[model samples]
Target: MAQPRRRATPTKRDLLRADLRRSTPEELSHALQMLLDQSRLSRDERLHALASALVVEALAPYWVGDRTPNQAHDALCADDEELARVIEALAPMLLGHIEVREEARDAVATIEAMLGF
Candidate 1:
């Protein structure tokens, strides 16, 4: 008798893609429109958006109902010094998002490369 083969576990990316495939046409259209809008944003604006997304993910464990991701980003931006510090701290994590690592590039540059902008 042949031994049974085990199935490979699904990765987060695989699961996400599967879920996306099941989305309604309207939902897919809305998602596509949002991506298109993001692509149209200026470099600075797109950098801000990427930083906000990073902050949102990092802060999710501590996020409360009253504080939204945009609100959290706004509060962080209000303190320019702190914002710089936060960006510096988040810079190492940005490495995982991009394919190639360039020496001495800032977070904005890394994000631009990640986004292909």
Candidate 2:
């Protein structure tokens, strides 16, 4: 009997790309706003949304291949000066919205360090 091949588990980047493909512009905008301002979402949720939006919406168009969020961040910092400037401009808003939650603090710090914030 022939067995079906099992699909590999989706990575976080895959999930984010899927979500971005599924979302409308309005929906993505609303989610971005929710992440930017105070919302019911936990800090972790907000951070996830931020990474998803930034990587999928902002960077993916310019990016050629699949990349994890961290990889994308590193690429932008190392190779893409224009995109790095864009992220720098956005840093203040993200920094302002940042909440000091124990669960998300390390993730936030990692992202901030990557962005040179």
Candidate 3:
């Protein structure tokens, strides 16, 4: 008799990291826009938190990657204006709904510091 092996489910962070890594720049912008729209329309605290976390995850690599936050931020702004615009548009909504969730706060703070807001 053979034993069956079970696969582990991915965590939310794992899923998010994968999504960010695999997304193209345009896809990333679209995802941010969708999250921003959800944040604007949804009153649910959990949904807001999730959206905020995703936005942060998308931007974190640029802001907190190998380069300095300022350097990454500068490069992003210079190289990808559309993506930068999407981030700028989403920042205030994320900041407004930031709650006790550490991921949400860190994400919002990363964008704010990156944008000099």
Q: Pick the candidate with the highest lDDT.
A: 3
Candidate 1 error regions (>4 Å): 1-38, 65-117
Clash pairs, candidate 1, are none
TM-score of each: 0.28, 0.28, 0.38
- Residue 98: error of model 1 in Å? 25
Best to worst by lDDT, what's the order? 3, 2, 1
Error of 2 at 85 (Å): 1.6
Q: Which is the better candidate, 1 or 3, if ranked by lDDT?
A: 3
lDDT of every predicted structure (CA atoms): 0.59, 0.64, 0.65
Candidate 3: RMSD over Cα atoms? Answer: 15.1
* Ranking of models by TM-score: 3, 2, 1
List candidate 3 stretches off by more than 4 Å: 1-43, 65-70, 99-117
Root-mean-square deviation of every model? 14.0, 16.5, 15.1
Assess the local accuracy of residue 38 in candidate 1 as a C-alpha lDDT between 0 and 100: 35
The CA lDDT at 87 in model 2 is 74
Q: Judge candidate 1 against the unseen true structure and give its global Cα lDDT, from 0 to 1.
A: 0.59
lDDT of 2: 0.64
